[model samples]
Target: MPPSPVVPCHSPVPDPSLYEPINTLKPVVPDVWIADGPVVRMAMPCGLSMPFTTRMTIVRLRDGGLWCHSPIAPDDALFAAIDALGPVRDLVSPNQLHYAHIAAWKRRYPHAVARASPGVSERAAAQDIEARFDAAFDDAAPSPWPGEIDPLLFRGSRAFGEVVFFHRASATLVLADLIENFEKEKLTRGMRAVARLGGVLDPDGKAPLDMRMTFTDRGAARDCLRQLLAWKPQRVLLAHGRWYERDGVEQLQRAFRWLE
Candidate 1:
Protein backbone atom coordinates (compact mmCIF):
# COMPACT_ATOMS: atom_id res chain seq x y z
CA MET A 1 0.00 0.00 0.00
CA PRO A 2 0.97 3.67 -0.57
CA PRO A 3 3.74 2.76 -3.05
CA SER A 4 5.71 1.02 -0.28
CA PRO A 5 6.55 4.30 1.44
CA VAL A 6 9.21 5.92 -0.72
CA VAL A 7 11.91 7.39 1.47
CA PRO A 8 13.46 10.63 0.28
CA CYS A 9 17.15 10.38 -0.44
CA HIS A 10 18.06 13.79 0.95
CA SER A 11 16.40 13.61 4.37
CA PRO A 12 18.83 14.10 7.25
CA VAL A 13 18.73 15.46 10.79
CA PRO A 14 21.65 16.91 12.76
CA ASP A 15 21.94 18.77 16.05
CA PRO A 16 19.64 21.79 16.03
CA SER A 17 22.39 23.72 17.83
CA LEU A 18 24.57 23.37 14.74
CA TYR A 19 22.30 25.96 13.11
CA GLU A 20 23.40 29.58 13.27
CA PRO A 21 20.39 31.84 13.61
CA ILE A 22 19.90 34.78 11.23
CA ASN A 23 16.72 36.37 12.61
CA THR A 24 16.20 40.01 11.75
CA LEU A 25 13.46 42.61 12.03
CA LYS A 26 13.76 43.77 8.45
CA PRO A 27 11.62 42.15 5.79
CA VAL A 28 13.40 39.42 3.83
CA VAL A 29 11.81 40.79 0.67
CA PRO A 30 11.91 44.53 0.30
CA ASP A 31 8.95 46.18 2.07
CA VAL A 32 7.01 42.90 2.23
CA TRP A 33 6.23 42.78 5.92
CA ILE A 34 4.49 39.88 7.65
CA ALA A 35 2.84 41.75 10.48
CA ASP A 36 5.48 41.76 13.25
CA GLY A 37 6.78 38.30 12.45
CA PRO A 38 10.41 37.95 11.37
CA VAL A 39 11.83 35.61 8.78
CA VAL A 40 14.43 33.49 10.60
CA ARG A 41 17.15 31.55 8.81
CA MET A 42 19.46 28.85 10.13
CA ALA A 43 22.46 27.11 8.58
CA MET A 44 22.55 23.33 9.12
CA PRO A 45 25.16 20.76 8.13
CA CYS A 46 24.02 18.01 5.77
CA GLY A 47 25.20 15.81 2.90
CA LEU A 48 28.38 17.17 1.29
CA SER A 49 27.59 20.70 2.37
CA MET A 50 29.40 21.76 5.57
CA PRO A 51 26.34 23.88 6.31
CA PHE A 52 23.31 25.05 4.34
CA THR A 53 20.90 27.80 5.29
CA THR A 54 17.16 27.17 5.62
CA ARG A 55 14.61 29.97 5.86
CA MET A 56 11.30 29.92 7.76
CA THR A 57 8.67 32.37 6.56
CA ILE A 58 6.48 33.44 9.50
CA VAL A 59 3.27 35.21 8.63
CA ARG A 60 0.67 36.46 11.12
CA LEU A 61 -2.85 35.59 10.06
CA ARG A 62 -5.93 37.80 10.56
CA ASP A 63 -6.85 35.84 13.68
CA GLY A 64 -3.50 36.62 15.36
CA GLY A 65 -1.90 33.22 14.76
CA LEU A 66 1.48 32.47 13.20
CA TRP A 67 1.72 30.47 9.97
CA CYS A 68 5.21 28.98 9.64
CA HIS A 69 6.30 27.74 6.23
CA SER A 70 9.15 25.22 5.81
CA PRO A 71 10.02 25.41 9.51
CA ILE A 72 13.60 24.87 10.62
CA ALA A 73 14.86 23.26 13.86
CA PRO A 74 13.13 25.10 16.69
CA ASP A 75 15.34 25.73 19.72
CA ASP A 76 14.16 27.33 22.97
CA ALA A 77 15.26 30.77 21.86
CA LEU A 78 13.45 30.28 18.57
CA PHE A 79 10.35 29.24 20.50
CA ALA A 80 10.48 32.43 22.57
CA ALA A 81 10.81 34.51 19.44
CA ILE A 82 7.85 32.71 17.86
CA ASP A 83 5.78 33.16 21.00
CA ALA A 84 6.34 36.91 20.86
CA LEU A 85 4.56 37.00 17.52
CA GLY A 86 1.48 34.98 18.50
CA PRO A 87 0.31 31.41 19.11
CA VAL A 88 1.54 29.02 16.46
CA ARG A 89 -1.41 27.79 14.44
CA ASP A 90 0.17 26.18 11.41
CA LEU A 91 3.47 24.32 10.99
CA VAL A 92 4.05 23.42 7.35
CA SER A 93 6.35 20.88 5.78
CA PRO A 94 6.52 22.20 2.25
CA ASN A 95 7.95 18.99 0.79
CA GLN A 96 8.94 15.43 1.58
CA LEU A 97 12.59 16.20 2.29
CA HIS A 98 11.81 19.04 4.71
CA TYR A 99 9.73 17.15 7.28
CA ALA A 100 12.55 16.33 9.71
CA HIS A 101 11.78 19.32 11.90
CA ILE A 102 7.99 19.24 11.67
CA ALA A 103 7.58 16.96 14.65
CA ALA A 104 9.83 19.10 16.82
CA TRP A 105 7.81 22.23 16.15
CA LYS A 106 4.55 20.39 16.78
CA ARG A 107 5.79 19.16 20.14
CA ARG A 108 6.51 22.73 21.09
CA TYR A 109 3.09 23.97 20.02
CA PRO A 110 0.60 21.23 20.77
CA HIS A 111 -2.36 23.15 19.37
CA ALA A 112 -0.67 23.91 16.06
CA VAL A 113 -1.88 22.01 13.01
CA ALA A 114 1.01 20.36 11.21
CA ARG A 115 0.36 20.09 7.48
CA ALA A 116 2.41 18.11 4.98
CA SER A 117 2.49 17.85 1.22
CA PRO A 118 1.70 14.72 -0.75
CA GLY A 119 4.15 11.82 -0.30
CA VAL A 120 5.36 13.17 3.05
CA SER A 121 3.50 10.75 5.35
CA GLU A 122 4.82 7.66 3.62
CA ARG A 123 8.35 8.98 3.44
CA ALA A 124 8.25 9.89 7.11
CA ALA A 125 6.88 6.48 7.97
CA ALA A 126 9.63 4.82 5.93
CA GLN A 127 12.31 6.90 7.58
CA ASP A 128 10.86 6.30 11.09
CA ILE A 129 10.08 9.97 11.64
CA GLU A 130 7.24 10.46 14.14
CA ALA A 131 5.49 13.12 12.08
CA ARG A 132 1.76 13.23 12.67
CA PHE A 133 0.33 15.35 9.91
CA ASP A 134 -2.99 16.85 10.91
CA ALA A 135 -3.70 17.87 7.35
CA ALA A 136 -2.23 17.63 3.84
CA PHE A 137 -2.06 20.41 1.28
CA ASP A 138 -3.97 20.04 -1.97
CA ASP A 139 -4.76 22.60 -4.69
CA ALA A 140 -7.02 24.63 -2.38
CA ALA A 141 -5.76 27.33 -0.04
CA PRO A 142 -6.01 26.62 3.68
CA SER A 143 -8.81 28.31 5.60
CA PRO A 144 -6.51 30.31 7.87
CA TRP A 145 -4.74 31.91 4.90
CA PRO A 146 -7.68 32.22 2.53
CA GLY A 147 -7.16 34.75 -0.28
CA GLU A 148 -3.73 35.54 1.22
CA ILE A 149 -1.76 32.50 0.04
CA ASP A 150 -2.30 30.04 -2.79
CA PRO A 151 -0.99 26.44 -2.86
CA LEU A 152 0.04 24.66 -6.06
CA LEU A 153 0.84 20.95 -6.10
CA PHE A 154 3.99 20.26 -8.13
CA ARG A 155 3.29 17.09 -10.07
CA GLY A 156 4.97 14.51 -12.40
CA SER A 157 8.10 14.13 -10.28
CA ARG A 158 8.02 10.43 -9.50
CA ALA A 159 10.64 11.09 -6.81
CA PHE A 160 7.96 12.99 -4.82
CA GLY A 161 5.42 15.80 -4.89
CA GLU A 162 5.76 19.22 -3.22
CA VAL A 163 3.42 22.17 -2.59
CA VAL A 164 4.44 25.66 -3.70
CA PHE A 165 2.81 28.78 -2.28
CA PHE A 166 2.33 32.31 -3.49
CA HIS A 167 1.88 34.91 -0.70
CA ARG A 168 -0.48 37.53 -2.09
CA ALA A 169 0.14 40.44 0.28
CA SER A 170 3.87 40.27 -0.30
CA ALA A 171 3.57 38.99 -3.87
CA THR A 172 6.10 36.32 -2.92
CA LEU A 173 6.34 32.81 -4.31
CA VAL A 174 7.53 30.20 -1.79
CA LEU A 175 9.13 26.98 -2.99
CA ALA A 176 10.86 23.91 -1.59
CA ASP A 177 13.35 22.03 -3.79
CA LEU A 178 11.61 23.03 -7.05
CA ILE A 179 14.53 25.41 -7.71
CA GLU A 180 17.74 26.19 -5.82
CA ASN A 181 19.95 29.31 -5.84
CA PHE A 182 22.86 28.48 -3.54
CA GLU A 183 25.56 31.13 -3.66
CA LYS A 184 28.94 29.60 -4.52
CA GLU A 185 30.65 31.54 -1.75
CA LYS A 186 28.49 29.94 0.97
CA LEU A 187 29.25 26.34 0.04
CA THR A 188 32.33 24.43 1.15
CA ARG A 189 34.71 22.91 -1.44
CA GLY A 190 33.13 19.45 -1.28
CA MET A 191 29.61 20.87 -1.41
CA ARG A 192 30.56 23.20 -4.25
CA ALA A 193 31.69 20.20 -6.26
CA VAL A 194 28.55 18.24 -5.36
CA ALA A 195 26.24 21.17 -6.09
CA ARG A 196 27.92 21.80 -9.41
CA LEU A 197 27.33 18.16 -10.34
CA GLY A 198 23.72 18.47 -9.14
CA GLY A 199 23.29 21.57 -11.36
CA VAL A 200 21.60 23.52 -8.56
CA LEU A 201 24.15 26.30 -7.95
CA ASP A 202 23.29 29.93 -8.60
CA PRO A 203 23.24 32.66 -11.30
CA ASP A 204 20.09 30.88 -12.47
CA GLY A 205 18.70 28.28 -10.08
CA LYS A 206 17.26 25.16 -11.68
CA ALA A 207 15.85 21.86 -10.47
CA PRO A 208 18.40 19.14 -9.79
CA LEU A 209 19.16 16.90 -12.75
CA ASP A 210 18.07 13.81 -10.83
CA MET A 211 14.74 15.43 -10.02
CA ARG A 212 14.22 16.73 -13.55
CA MET A 213 14.82 13.26 -14.96
CA THR A 214 12.16 11.74 -12.65
CA PHE A 215 9.31 13.54 -14.35
CA THR A 216 7.78 11.05 -16.81
CA ASP A 217 4.78 13.29 -17.43
CA ARG A 218 5.94 16.63 -18.73
CA GLY A 219 2.43 17.99 -19.21
CA ALA A 220 1.69 18.04 -15.48
CA ALA A 221 4.89 19.88 -14.65
CA ARG A 222 4.31 22.43 -17.39
CA ASP A 223 0.75 23.00 -16.27
CA CYS A 224 1.94 23.79 -12.73
CA LEU A 225 4.56 26.16 -14.11
CA ARG A 226 1.98 27.97 -16.20
CA GLN A 227 -0.21 28.49 -13.13
CA LEU A 228 2.80 29.83 -11.23
CA LEU A 229 3.51 32.30 -14.05
CA ALA A 230 -0.09 33.52 -13.85
CA TRP A 231 0.29 34.31 -10.14
CA LYS A 232 2.79 37.09 -11.01
CA PRO A 233 4.56 37.05 -7.63
CA GLN A 234 7.22 39.75 -7.31
CA ARG A 235 9.61 37.79 -5.06
CA VAL A 236 10.53 34.09 -4.94
CA LEU A 237 11.75 32.31 -1.76
CA LEU A 238 13.62 29.04 -2.00
CA ALA A 239 14.09 26.81 1.05
CA HIS A 240 17.73 25.88 0.42
CA GLY A 241 19.22 28.84 -1.41
CA ARG A 242 19.26 32.58 -1.97
CA TRP A 243 15.78 33.99 -2.69
CA TYR A 244 14.87 36.27 -5.58
CA GLU A 245 13.89 39.62 -4.12
CA ARG A 246 12.93 41.12 -7.48
CA ASP A 247 11.31 39.85 -10.65
CA GLY A 248 10.06 36.65 -9.02
CA VAL A 249 7.91 35.77 -12.02
CA GLU A 250 10.85 36.08 -14.41
CA GLN A 251 13.11 34.06 -12.13
CA LEU A 252 10.54 31.24 -11.93
CA GLN A 253 10.24 31.20 -15.75
CA ARG A 254 14.02 30.94 -16.12
CA ALA A 255 14.34 28.26 -13.43
CA PHE A 256 11.62 26.00 -14.88
CA ARG A 257 12.63 26.57 -18.49
CA TRP A 258 13.84 22.97 -18.68
CA LEU A 259 10.23 21.81 -18.31
CA GLU A 260 9.48 23.47 -21.66
Candidate 2:
Protein backbone atom coordinates (compact mmCIF):
# COMPACT_ATOMS: atom_id res chain seq x y z
CA MET A 1 0.00 0.00 0.00
CA PRO A 2 1.23 3.57 -0.78
CA PRO A 3 2.17 5.69 2.23
CA SER A 4 -0.28 8.40 3.21
CA PRO A 5 0.57 11.88 2.03
CA VAL A 6 2.13 14.11 4.65
CA VAL A 7 0.18 17.37 5.04
CA PRO A 8 1.89 20.30 6.69
CA CYS A 9 0.39 21.52 9.95
CA HIS A 10 0.69 25.25 10.39
CA SER A 11 -1.11 27.64 12.68
CA PRO A 12 -2.73 30.77 11.31
CA VAL A 13 -0.91 34.06 11.72
CA PRO A 14 -2.11 36.26 14.59
CA ASP A 15 -4.31 39.20 13.71
CA PRO A 16 -1.83 41.64 15.20
CA SER A 17 0.62 40.69 12.48
CA LEU A 18 -1.63 42.62 10.08
CA TYR A 19 -1.29 46.32 9.41
CA GLU A 20 -1.93 48.29 12.59
CA PRO A 21 -4.88 50.59 13.29
CA ILE A 22 -7.21 48.34 11.38
CA ASN A 23 -10.29 49.77 9.69
CA THR A 24 -9.05 53.36 10.14
CA LEU A 25 -7.88 55.76 7.49
CA LYS A 26 -4.13 56.14 7.01
CA PRO A 27 -3.22 59.03 4.80
CA VAL A 28 -1.16 58.03 1.77
CA VAL A 29 -1.27 61.39 0.03
CA PRO A 30 -3.20 64.66 0.14
CA ASP A 31 -6.45 63.21 -1.18
CA VAL A 32 -5.76 59.47 -1.00
CA TRP A 33 -5.96 57.20 2.06
CA ILE A 34 -5.66 53.48 2.81
CA ALA A 35 -7.34 51.35 5.43
CA ASP A 36 -6.11 47.92 6.50
CA GLY A 37 -8.53 45.35 7.78
CA PRO A 38 -8.77 41.89 9.35
CA VAL A 39 -7.04 38.91 7.80
CA VAL A 40 -8.94 36.88 5.22
CA ARG A 41 -7.98 33.24 4.86
CA MET A 42 -7.92 32.45 1.18
CA ALA A 43 -7.77 28.88 -0.01
CA MET A 44 -4.51 27.84 -1.56
CA PRO A 45 -3.53 24.77 -3.51
CA CYS A 46 -2.81 21.57 -1.59
CA GLY A 47 -5.65 22.07 0.87
CA LEU A 48 -3.94 25.00 2.54
CA SER A 49 -5.25 28.38 3.58
CA MET A 50 -3.23 31.51 3.00
CA PRO A 51 -3.94 34.36 5.40
CA PHE A 52 -4.33 37.54 3.38
CA THR A 53 -4.24 40.98 5.00
CA THR A 54 -7.00 43.01 3.44
CA ARG A 55 -6.62 46.67 2.43
CA MET A 56 -8.79 49.34 0.77
CA THR A 57 -8.04 52.66 -0.93
CA ILE A 58 -10.14 55.83 -0.69
CA VAL A 59 -9.84 58.87 -2.88
CA ARG A 60 -11.59 62.15 -2.13
CA LEU A 61 -12.72 63.59 -5.43
CA ARG A 62 -12.80 67.34 -6.00
CA ASP A 63 -16.60 67.14 -5.70
CA GLY A 64 -16.28 65.91 -2.11
CA GLY A 65 -17.47 62.50 -3.15
CA LEU A 66 -15.53 59.53 -1.80
CA TRP A 67 -14.35 56.80 -4.19
CA CYS A 68 -13.64 53.51 -2.44
CA HIS A 69 -11.72 50.68 -4.08
CA SER A 70 -11.83 47.10 -2.86
CA PRO A 71 -13.61 47.94 0.38
CA ILE A 72 -12.91 45.56 3.24
CA ALA A 73 -15.15 44.28 6.01
CA PRO A 74 -17.27 47.17 7.31
CA ASP A 75 -17.59 48.35 10.88
CA ASP A 76 -19.31 51.33 12.53
CA ALA A 77 -16.10 53.23 13.22
CA LEU A 78 -14.82 52.67 9.69
CA PHE A 79 -18.12 53.84 8.21
CA ALA A 80 -18.16 56.89 10.50
CA ALA A 81 -14.60 57.75 9.51
CA ILE A 82 -15.49 57.36 5.83
CA ASP A 83 -18.52 59.61 6.31
CA ALA A 84 -16.32 62.28 7.85
CA LEU A 85 -14.20 62.27 4.71
CA GLY A 86 -17.23 62.97 2.50
CA PRO A 87 -20.31 61.38 1.04
CA VAL A 88 -19.78 57.85 -0.23
CA ARG A 89 -20.34 58.19 -3.96
CA ASP A 90 -18.56 55.26 -5.57
CA LEU A 91 -17.97 51.82 -4.11
CA VAL A 92 -15.75 49.84 -6.46
CA SER A 93 -14.64 46.25 -6.79
CA PRO A 94 -11.32 46.33 -8.56
CA ASN A 95 -11.40 42.62 -9.42
CA GLN A 96 -13.75 39.67 -9.25
CA LEU A 97 -12.25 38.20 -6.08
CA HIS A 98 -12.43 41.56 -4.31
CA TYR A 99 -16.20 42.06 -4.54
CA ALA A 100 -17.19 40.08 -1.46
CA HIS A 101 -17.60 43.18 0.70
CA ILE A 102 -19.38 45.44 -1.79
CA ALA A 103 -22.77 44.19 -0.66
CA ALA A 104 -22.06 45.31 2.90
CA TRP A 105 -20.90 48.72 1.75
CA LYS A 106 -23.95 49.07 -0.52
CA ARG A 107 -26.23 48.43 2.44
CA ARG A 108 -24.52 51.28 4.27
CA TYR A 109 -24.48 53.66 1.34
CA PRO A 110 -27.52 52.93 -0.78
CA HIS A 111 -27.06 55.98 -2.96
CA ALA A 112 -23.44 55.18 -3.70
CA VAL A 113 -23.02 53.44 -7.04
CA ALA A 114 -21.52 49.98 -6.63
CA ARG A 115 -19.26 49.56 -9.60
CA ALA A 116 -18.26 46.07 -10.62
CA SER A 117 -15.10 44.93 -12.36
CA PRO A 118 -15.17 42.66 -15.42
CA GLY A 119 -16.82 39.29 -14.61
CA VAL A 120 -17.34 40.36 -11.01
CA SER A 121 -21.13 40.11 -11.07
CA GLU A 122 -20.98 36.68 -12.67
CA ARG A 123 -18.34 35.50 -10.24
CA ALA A 124 -20.38 36.70 -7.29
CA ALA A 125 -23.54 35.06 -8.53
CA ALA A 126 -21.74 31.75 -9.06
CA GLN A 127 -20.40 31.91 -5.53
CA ASP A 128 -23.86 32.77 -4.19
CA ILE A 129 -22.52 36.04 -2.89
CA GLU A 130 -25.16 38.77 -2.68
CA ALA A 131 -23.83 41.85 -4.51
CA ARG A 132 -25.36 44.39 -6.86
CA PHE A 133 -23.69 46.86 -9.18
CA ASP A 134 -25.14 49.92 -10.90
CA ALA A 135 -22.48 49.85 -13.62
CA ALA A 136 -19.44 47.92 -14.76
CA PHE A 137 -15.96 49.26 -15.40
CA ASP A 138 -14.69 49.65 -18.95
CA ASP A 139 -11.41 50.67 -20.54
CA ALA A 140 -12.18 54.33 -19.91
CA ALA A 141 -12.80 56.13 -16.68
CA PRO A 142 -16.44 56.71 -15.82
CA SER A 143 -18.24 59.95 -15.01
CA PRO A 144 -18.09 61.94 -11.72
CA TRP A 145 -14.31 61.43 -11.63
CA PRO A 146 -13.29 61.14 -15.23
CA GLY A 147 -10.02 63.03 -15.29
CA GLU A 148 -9.52 62.77 -11.55
CA ILE A 149 -9.03 59.00 -11.56
CA ASP A 150 -8.27 56.95 -14.66
CA PRO A 151 -9.38 53.31 -14.78
CA LEU A 152 -7.81 50.62 -16.94
CA LEU A 153 -8.79 47.00 -17.27
CA PHE A 154 -5.62 44.90 -17.01
CA ARG A 155 -6.72 42.14 -19.34
CA GLY A 156 -5.12 38.93 -20.78
CA SER A 157 -5.93 36.62 -17.89
CA ARG A 158 -9.01 34.70 -18.92
CA ALA A 159 -9.64 33.59 -15.32
CA PHE A 160 -10.16 37.10 -13.92
CA GLY A 161 -9.74 40.75 -14.85
CA GLU A 162 -8.60 43.59 -12.56
CA VAL A 163 -9.35 47.29 -13.04
CA VAL A 164 -6.35 49.33 -12.03
CA PHE A 165 -6.75 53.00 -11.13
CA PHE A 166 -4.43 55.96 -11.46
CA HIS A 167 -5.22 59.03 -9.36
CA ARG A 168 -3.89 62.02 -11.28
CA ALA A 169 -3.91 64.45 -8.38
CA SER A 170 -1.73 62.30 -6.15
CA ALA A 171 0.01 60.32 -8.88
CA THR A 172 -0.94 57.20 -7.01
CA LEU A 173 -1.61 53.90 -8.76
CA VAL A 174 -4.18 51.71 -7.01
CA LEU A 175 -4.08 47.96 -7.53
CA ALA A 176 -5.97 44.98 -6.17
CA ASP A 177 -3.63 42.05 -6.81
CA LEU A 178 -1.24 42.84 -9.68
CA ILE A 179 1.54 43.05 -7.10
CA GLU A 180 1.46 41.73 -3.56
CA ASN A 181 4.37 42.48 -1.21
CA PHE A 182 3.87 40.60 2.03
CA GLU A 183 6.24 41.51 4.83
CA LYS A 184 8.04 38.51 6.27
CA GLU A 185 7.82 39.72 9.86
CA LYS A 186 4.03 39.88 9.64
CA LEU A 187 3.58 36.30 8.48
CA THR A 188 3.45 32.96 10.20
CA ARG A 189 6.04 30.35 9.39
CA GLY A 190 3.63 28.53 7.15
CA MET A 191 2.43 31.73 5.49
CA ARG A 192 5.99 32.87 4.97
CA ALA A 193 6.73 29.61 3.22
CA VAL A 194 3.70 30.06 1.03
CA ALA A 195 4.48 33.68 0.27
CA ARG A 196 8.04 32.81 -0.63
CA LEU A 197 6.90 30.05 -2.92
CA GLY A 198 4.23 32.29 -4.48
CA GLY A 199 6.78 35.11 -5.08
CA VAL A 200 4.72 37.61 -3.12
CA LEU A 201 7.19 38.44 -0.34
CA ASP A 202 8.26 42.05 -0.02
CA PRO A 203 11.31 43.62 -1.71
CA ASP A 204 10.81 41.24 -4.65
CA GLY A 205 7.07 40.76 -4.81
CA LYS A 206 5.27 40.32 -8.09
CA ALA A 207 2.13 38.63 -9.27
CA PRO A 208 1.69 35.24 -7.65
CA LEU A 209 3.04 32.40 -9.78
CA ASP A 210 -0.43 31.04 -10.45
CA MET A 211 -1.77 34.42 -11.48
CA ARG A 212 1.17 35.19 -13.75
CA MET A 213 0.58 31.99 -15.66
CA THR A 214 -3.03 32.97 -16.43
CA PHE A 215 -1.85 35.80 -18.67
CA THR A 216 -1.87 33.66 -21.79
CA ASP A 217 -2.16 36.79 -23.91
CA ARG A 218 0.91 38.68 -22.79
CA GLY A 219 0.45 41.15 -25.60
CA ALA A 220 -2.84 42.44 -24.24
CA ALA A 221 -1.37 42.59 -20.74
CA ARG A 222 1.62 44.47 -22.08
CA ASP A 223 -0.63 47.06 -23.68
CA CYS A 224 -2.28 47.62 -20.30
CA LEU A 225 1.07 47.90 -18.60
CA ARG A 226 2.18 50.54 -21.06
CA GLN A 227 -0.84 52.70 -20.24
CA LEU A 228 -0.20 52.42 -16.48
CA LEU A 229 3.43 53.39 -16.90
CA ALA A 230 2.38 56.33 -19.05
CA TRP A 231 0.57 57.67 -16.01
CA LYS A 232 3.99 57.96 -14.32
CA PRO A 233 2.62 57.32 -10.88
CA GLN A 234 4.56 58.61 -7.91
CA ARG A 235 3.10 56.19 -5.43
CA VAL A 236 1.64 52.70 -5.76
CA LEU A 237 -1.14 51.57 -3.41
CA LEU A 238 -1.89 47.87 -3.14
CA ALA A 239 -4.64 45.93 -1.36
CA HIS A 240 -2.23 43.47 0.22
CA GLY A 241 1.24 43.81 1.80
CA ARG A 242 3.42 46.92 2.13
CA TRP A 243 2.68 49.49 -0.59
CA TYR A 244 5.26 51.42 -2.56
CA GLU A 245 5.41 55.06 -1.45
CA ARG A 246 7.93 56.18 -4.05
CA ASP A 247 9.31 55.17 -7.43
CA GLY A 248 5.92 53.88 -8.51
CA VAL A 249 7.01 53.37 -12.09
CA GLU A 250 10.14 51.51 -11.12
CA GLN A 251 8.25 49.30 -8.71
CA LEU A 252 5.68 48.52 -11.36
CA GLN A 253 8.38 47.66 -13.84
CA ARG A 254 10.04 45.36 -11.36
CA ALA A 255 6.81 43.68 -10.30
CA PHE A 256 5.76 42.88 -13.82
CA ARG A 257 9.17 41.93 -15.14
CA TRP A 258 7.77 38.56 -16.09
CA LEU A 259 6.07 40.28 -19.00
CA GLU A 260 9.38 41.15 -20.57
Candidate that scores best on TM-score: 2
RMSD of 1: 12.3
TM-score for every candidate vs. truth? 0.81, 0.92
Error of 2 at 181 (Å): 0.9
Worst lDDT run of 10 residues, candidate 2, spans 137-146
Candidate 1 lDDT over residue span 1-260, tens digit each: 55787777884553342223344323565323321112234332333323456667777666778778877766666777778778999888888887888888888888999998888899899989889789987666454478877878888888868888887877888887888766777666776766777778887778877788889889999998989999998888776667788998889889998888
Root-mean-square deviation per candidate? 12.3, 8.6
Clash-forming residue pairs, model 1:
none
lDDT of 2 by residue, 88-149 (tens): 99999999889999999999999999998899899899999999899887665454477798
